[model samples]
Target: MTSPYPPSTSISPSDMAAGAKKPTDLPQAQIDAIIRTKRKAREPKACYPCHARKVKCDRNLPCDGCVKRDHADLCSYERPSKKRAQAFESPAGASTSSAAEPTEYYSYDDIPSRVKPENTHPGPDHLGVGGRVSIARDEWDNVRSRLKEMETTISSLRMGLERAEESPAVGPDSGSVQSAEGASRSKGNSPEREGIHAANTFGKGTVHLGSRSVMAYILNNKSGSDQLQALLEGGILPKLGLDNESATYPFVDLWSSDMSSFDISAVCSALPADGQCRQFFYYYRDISGAIYPVIEDITKFENDLELLLAKRLEAGGVYREDGDQAQTPFGTSIAYLGLLYAVLASGCQSSDLGSKERELTSQVYVCCSYQCLRMTNFLSQPTIEAIQTLLVIGNVLSYNMNPGISYVLLGMTLRMGLALGLHVESSRFSVEERYRRRHTWWSMAWQDSHFSLSYDRPSTTAVSQPNIAYREGSQPGDFSYFETLCKVISLALEVVRIRMLSPNAHITFSSFQEYQERIRQIMIEAKPYLRDPQYCSSSTEHLERVVLKLHSSYFCSELCRPSLKPSAGRADANTVAMRKDCVSNLVTTVDAYIELHNISYHAARSWIALQRAISSAFLLAVVEEAKSDSHVLTALRRLEGIIAQRASSERAYDNGDVATSNITSSDQGMASYDPVTGATNPRGLSHPLSMLPLLRDLAPNLKLNGPNL
Candidate 1:
């Protein structure tokens, strides 16, 4: 192309001698390139909004500065047109005269869009040995997209398969799946589902009382379901001469305004006489205390009790004006009274008194204790004493067949302990104080773990906190049973976390074996404290050993029981061995519980002991091979006989003629007894014996000749 500009009017002599080209003497292409480079260099890279506002721009499609300024719609990077370049070249009127009308400015929307380049080297669509087939870029892209979609589908299916493998499938024989499908179909037929309506009513939510709970486990078994259904349909209670209405006991209304009225005189009057109080305190110390050991200083507690009673006597059983001043620390505090009363109630409950007297006395004291606790505002200002009272109350309730209440109360108690900083070790505290805190914290944790395991619920107390080093006893060589119990419970809680709370969804056989080995090691380490003659010399120590032994076996059996489930599938040699071991441990647990009961009826009255026994008995009854075992039959019969005798004694007492009742049992001298509490009907067997019917059905050959009650 020809040059568009004229030559320069002047040139340097040095440039001419060196033969370098002048700017005005260059070719048209070189001149145009120089103009384009200068134009490009001066052009703005930022959007017009950012450039006009004089702010830094990210230079994105919609520059950040423009977006922040709310002018993203006008954020254009368009530069001035070539008209400006032409005007620059012809600064005089020569070019301006030709376009003298007006200058026109183009908006961003007026700018034409750039055209995309075509693919000149599109690859072959298919490759072959002989030749290849050429295709468009769009066709290759389409093929890639389909392959990506298929890959995604395959990945989703693989994940679903893995999840299905982790969860147990419902067997065809089990109607649960069919029932669920039927329920879904029924719901689909509802009018509410046909259209979207502004409904005011809310649907009821389903409650999942844990699938692993003992009751749920039994209900899941086919035979157990049939037996329980038959009993329900046949009106077992009516046949046993018990009214359905009589079975339900009215719960004590703690929230009532009447219960809110706290009377110091009433509490003092409700308490047993001095000697009787001493006896009851001793009972708690020997029975519940031996197991939990929440009370750090028994002597100090007794001294405080004496002071409280003496002050009450001096005040003539009324609130003394100077009582708070006289007993600055313990005696005057409402929490202390609650603690004392709770201990007394626990003792009274464990006593050999007649069922009526025991229940009445314990209820009175329990009410007094609760009133005192309410008055103290324990929820807001929980103390060591208040927590102690709750623990005792929970212990009493657990044995009284109120495990649900106990579980809830224990959860509250654990939270209270955490609030009191009992979980943390404080150097400012005295050695005795530190020990008390440790004992209280671990006691709550141990109880919480047991209840959570029994209920198949998550524990409120986690093992990760506190970070406090556990001492077996405050003093050396003490051989604390509470410590042993805590250790075992801690190990069991670990297994629960792995098996239930783990992300893996299911426990493998190898993992189960690993947990079993860990439990075995813990038991081995605890054997010395459990079996040493020095520790087991006293009666309390002996009882502790027996209870510990029972719990140890129960935990072992529980670890194995899941393996025996129908979901566990066919049994290998190892599984068979584990089943045998489970049966053996269950038998041992039952035997130990029977022995514990024989030694001290109060000791065996614990809900945990009863639960373990019942669970083991039912498991034995369910296993085909175990049903025919003579030893199992003998133990179950003995347990049944004891339950029947207690029920008959209770019936006789209800008749209001205890002396005239024809009771030929060996313990006939003892008053009418009810080992389990909270019976539906006072004249019938307690809830614990409701499972006996199932046992009877399973072991028909064995003579469990106990009455229906």
Candidate 2:
């Protein structure tokens, strides 16, 4: 059979059936058909070298390419089979085009693009279905892991504190059975003992308790145990088996900042040059200062800035004719730099730049601030500056559509506040220091409460301590209004946690009315400032007042939300009137956002503002479905207009279309938050917080923006 052909190319029965025949017995056409069949069968899966080079594959387990390249061991033909591809099909429905294609033949880039899923872009609601499912699974794993770690850390810390407690007092009278307080008091007459006790007891300065007995004595004297119990019972913190001795004081070591984790040199190198930093700082001072006045003593802050600039210049951060220094000295306190970076980050976000560009700019500064904070060991040291920096970081996160992580950062700030004794109103620190502490405490509370509401979680920063009245001639510049706004928002948050989250919970109308009155008083106090032209002489003042009013209006909307809920049975006339009033409040709230956007479109797009806008729009859309109102329609259109503007700006920026006309062009690209009926959320079937199962296969075009949504 192989008489005329080479022995290696002998035609077997299978080859004969495939049209192969002995060369002497076959026509040229039949021989050519056989050769083509052999060539097609010889196509190889890529060998390692060929794959690495991105050259054509021969499809052989060990193709001639691999044999010639001496890479037989690196050759592979294994890939997902047809059955495996079929398994990837979702239960809802397989993507028909995708399903018909062979898995092994397709590259990831070969997949055709599809339409974007609803609500997955153009705004914060960008957790596409596939992304949401993946993030849920990942966050679930992380939460469980963190919980376990917290449990272990808490248990270990408690044991250490307890063993320290069991040890006898470490002073003059050895093993005397005097109470911890009596012992501490006896030793406190000494100058050094008194200072340590004062600092630890009132959170004045450094809490340097060398012995457990001293710590126990101080804690007991201050009734620290009772405070811990109150915090746990009030649900201000997770029930983490906390001992008062451990809870009230910073562990000084546990969860302490890791210095090595920070790379200051890298952060500095990544930062925009010194000139850009100054520009951002000025912008922050002028604009963001009206909202968050973190840096109180501007003069002292500038002195600190000089030191940072010198260090940066020395580090080759500045381009000067004199040339850069080979070695740069490390600044004493990275905390100051952290604050500066955060301020710049905030300023960049609020800038009149393209969204993508602004985000990138802001992100760089945020990372820089975060790095500086970590390098300075901020967790162990609770300075006003450090707390302020944390607050800024939280705000930045929320602004970037990341509320969950922001909430975690805020929690850390709260814990730091506790460690610093901001909760106690003692005269241990200077009057200025005391004022800073008070403001910082309230700021933390506001952030905690607001973020909790956004995430539908319980408020964690409880304000159970007696309020410290702001002393006359002591309030920082323009801080009074900011403080007042925070106070009002904090009160509204209590309503949020109690009513909106747990609507069925029992509460008397009298208490509710009392809460309402508190809000009313705040609004009344701020009314003159908001309404009086004399009070708001400048644009900043006017804008601040507008922000204050907007928040108050939003608060009123939230306060009336519960009453607007459908009743189980027929509602009375009073109930019906209350519902109508609720609708009116919602309309007013929407109007407030519209008004804010008109006043400052840049400011209106801030995280809190955008959240309020989305919330009101969603509510109005729902209400409109049941009862049509002209006001509701107007509000909806206005909200849509703002969203459209944002979409247009973002699209123009992304497409490199930076002309003013392009940005101003009308856009219909607003993402939807189409409300789901009942208690379900729009995205997933699972509880809003829980991670839902993912689809087996992601459509080719779906993009996921992960947990930020």
Candidate 3:
């Protein structure tokens, strides 16, 4: 598929949906049959729980055997509990209370009258299992194919000062070979070099060049998102009780500012009108090294861009004298790493941020979660993808499949969310209204048809000032939220993490299956809550405006809207020089997302904040290993400063009476980091810095909030 492959010749799987039968308006008798099928559990497979309890032999079986035999009272097959369960069968026809709890299901009256079907959803744990045949593992080759489509998107990057066609803002000339002493001097000894050169020799110790070639962009075109949307909007999903309201809208923004500001004119100043700048667009990379036609210059530009990214991260937006503007989702998820190329391809570069601390770590997860959440909403609350994304990045997943990272990261986010009191203690929506709002967040983000409630905290407890990693260059857990918001983070992380075992791997596979079983139990128990069908209608106010995020389609279809498709318009020989800045722009654009995610989401959670800090440390190791990814290191240092300052700021605010409940609940919500203004004013931006000077000045101002911004 990565071969600039031809289109497929198969019918859309949805056009012939496997079970798109049984008219929308079914007879009550048909409903009754399905309902009866659900109410009366199937013979053997359904009897395991009861058999484990060592109950009587009447079984709900032989078609009403339990009901016929007075053992109906013991026929507890309805609802399941999520928190705990596991008991063994005994030889005698007696049972013990070793089982966690009896099954729980929605009572007939508990369900909404609007639902055409009765209370027959088998509660949560055993959702949609009956009256439906399981698809074979091979049957899901379509999903694997979709994943293959995703796999074509991997790439690696490097950083440093290098030779340029013209004098770049940073780095000495590469082809102008340096003598040993000249190279040995660090940043202070020479204005032309830094403490960086000790590592950036490009293939000696750390800076290993790409061994071979493998870079390709294989676009995906086979998603059934439109049909899924149709199903969702048509109430088909709600009808199936798959309509769960999501508790969060990850990014605060709707539309990312368009690319109206970019200018490719300057490169024309030195160009011969050849298409080299344009030709670099189609290149791909594999294991073997494939040099970009524009790499010599573009790579240096990447270093320059990191300086810009630092400013943008501090400034909270981009500003270009040439009018090139780039934007991203505020709480960018993991997939936003794709922006690494998008920006690079646009001829803009970004910072290295060491390895893990930047947007690639946080934003990558954000993007992955965003996509996975949407994918889950499309498929039935499948928690596996988000888990896998987190697991793959840092498989610190331990025996229970819970990563210490997950614990720290998720716990941090939850704590911050609580302490920030983001939507807490207000004249907030009632349960029903909150459910509706959650539905919009879910629809926009995940297309989920269930899971209507936010991760709930128990009754209002007097919150204490939590602990944080407030010091400069602190490791994880440096925020005040880490101690208080434990339950929320622990549970959410537990849910997202347990499903991420690599079944194909030797260590995690068997346990992975067990994890799957555990998740099956948890989700089934949580289904009734997630599949809250009270939210059957799509008439909520946010519904019309909420655009559901879906997987991008490479092939053209009216159903999918086009994402960023920039034309390096009218490139001439000089566009190469100008395009050199593209790597920098890409870096800034990306780090902007990273900074935003850490600040906006993870920063709120103490544990997650600390987890991110640890990731940042590891990433710093990666950067140190690479030796010369200076921009990345600079970005990381800048980020560390930003994080410390924010934490300190929040710690101060939290210490103040304003963080207290007695101050009047009306003003409870407090920003740990000052809100970003999305400042467009160039005055708030670097007015006009010389390329060389701007490159040299990497000192970031964490407290300098833009006035106009």
Candidate 4:
């Protein structure tokens, strides 16, 4: 071999046995070039999509997996970069050694120059590779992190389950285990004592006692309980279904109806003529406005209405006094429209329009008001005007025999008022502004308290500081009526709060008696001012007096209702006497309600007054049936007579007999009206012996004799 080959290419016996030269003996540039070539040759065999998804491929131009996935166009292979490969190779002496053994091929890691000593596995950017491998690495790290988190969560849940299994089972008498555990943790106190402590703590936050409702008390009585169950089972009472249609207004799906079709022009055209509008406004100002006093500036409101009407005539579309475009959705103009329509609706209800006309016209205005409010997105962007509009709408709905809907609207209005900081007194504002805010917030509180009592639900309106001030002198202004009303309602709410205390707590009979005394004291203080000859001159003043009396009597009876239940333990002589007094208060309450209906046209159609009257009568009937007292029976009969008369009048109105149905004074001595001041003649209205048929059905001893019966 030495004789045939050149001296430079000579192969010795040792070199032949070794098969190849060592990689360390080679040049660095040559080693890098070889590693690059090996990596290029290790390219994926499948198409790019298949490789990325890690799926099997047939190695076709458009692989079967890619075709199935509807991505055949993206099935081309990714070729190794020639420029990257060339950058690593030295221009000269970069050729491969043919004598180099095939088994000694270099891998990427074997190239010492490509990797740093500190980091054996460099990033893809450092390695000059494609993004596919980098993405796969990142996803793998994410999966590992998620698995660790799941393991931690599972361990925590397992520990909780083990603890739960070791705990004692709960029982009705012992209360919930969590409650027991919470009680036991409190500094060595017994579970029962701790339970009472916890309940008392919870009761401090509650504003109403749902369990102390009149219906609940009646059901607590054995006789009334059985009769009520039987009546409900026999379907004697109307089914209380949650449907849209009602006797007062037809069902209109304002929530789902197409709002794009709303026409401002059509809404304007539907408004009452200017003269009629003024008449309706005056009617509301004298009746509902006199009571609530929510609108502080009547002159400003009237001027705004006139300006709105003028602008509507000039613009031929939605008009904003603030120069906002008609196309703006949540503009002041839309909210103003809602407010105006709501006022008009309430006024219409208070007006002496025929029964059908009142319902139909008020219904139209209400729907329009709702549409405008929705268009303005009042929930997200509440304003003072929007709150006022909602208050009026709630009042209108409450009287329209829709108290449930009215309550829901009142809740929304409360939230809106809170959002505008109306519930809080701010010294930063002007005196006028502060008074206006106080007026609105107190009105909401008044409405909310009454509604809460009516429905036996919790009130959302919390009493805040800086109470509305009463005038100092004996002479009473318009504010005097509202202030007195608020005082009475506040006392009633306090009674409700006390009743919410836990049964296990140590509440004394003296506490309830104290509340009853407070209610009486407020009524006494109000009587002198309320009966002032100068103050009681207007129909509004007279109406206020009657309403104040109704609330006082009803709430006084409410404070004594619990003692009537047998489950309340044996009653002492004081409790027995209190029960008799409660019955008398119920009679007075019902009578005052009847007088309210007689004096005011608005009260005649008010569902709130009607509901209060009926509930009081029912409670009276329940007590009379339980005790079989002749005095209670006589009081029940008188209430029944008044209700029967009102029901008959409503039926006549429904039948379109306005002449006979119109509440007026007559020689026959029906409900007498004072036409001059719009109040009832105190001497004319009388309660003849009668009975409600429903009450008779509920209590068999009740004798039915009225025309309604």
RMSD of each: 19.4, 34.0, 32.7, 23.8
State the lDDT of candidate 4 residue by residue for 550-635, as single tens digits.
77788777767666666554547767766666777877887776667656646444555555666776676566533466655655
Model 1 misplacement above 4 A: 1-208, 229-261, 323-330, 426-428, 463-478, 503-529, 532-535, 652-709
2 or 4, which is superior by TM-score? Answer: 4
Candidate 2 structure quality by residue, lDDT tens digits, 223-331 = 2323322322232111110111112211121222564654455555555666766666665655465665555555777677777787667756642222353222245
Indicate whether candidate 2 or candidate 4 has the larger lDDT.
Answer: 4
Worst 10 residues of 3 by lDDT: 210-219
- TM-score order, best first, reads 1, 4, 2, 3
TM-score of 4: 0.61
Tens digit of per-residue lDDT, candidate 3, span 1-709 = 3778776334344423643333334344344444544563332433323443333333323313343333444445443332223343444633553342245444322321111223554332222323322223453456558766664542111111112212323354321112323232212122111101112121223111110100000001112223222322222211111111121222222222332222222211211112322222211110000111112123533444454445445544533233333332222322322222232222201111111232223332233333323323422332222322332222111111122223233333333334433223334546433433222221111111001111111111112212211223433222111111121222323322321221111112233334435433433333132223342132111111110000000001100111110222225443332333322332343244233333222112222122223222222222112124566555544444443433333334335432321111111122112212321111100001111121122122112222211
Q: Number of clashing residue pairs in every model?
A: 2, 6, 79, 0
Backbone clashes in model 4, listed as residue pairs: none
Which ranges in model 4 have alpha carbons more than 4 Å from their true place?
1-209, 233-256, 260-262, 298-334, 463-466, 469-479, 499-508, 524-529, 532-535, 569-571, 625-635, 658-693
Kindly report which residue stretches of model 2 are placed more than 4 angstroms away from their true locations once superposed.
1-263, 296-303, 306-332, 466-471, 474-479, 493-503, 506-516, 532-535, 568-570, 624-627, 660-709
TM for every model, in the order presented, reads 0.64, 0.53, 0.17, 0.61
Best by lDDT: 1
Q: Which ten residues in a row have the lowest lDDT in candidate 4?
A: 236-245
Q: Global lDDT for candidate 1? A: 0.59
Cα deviation in Å at residue 431, candidate 3? 17
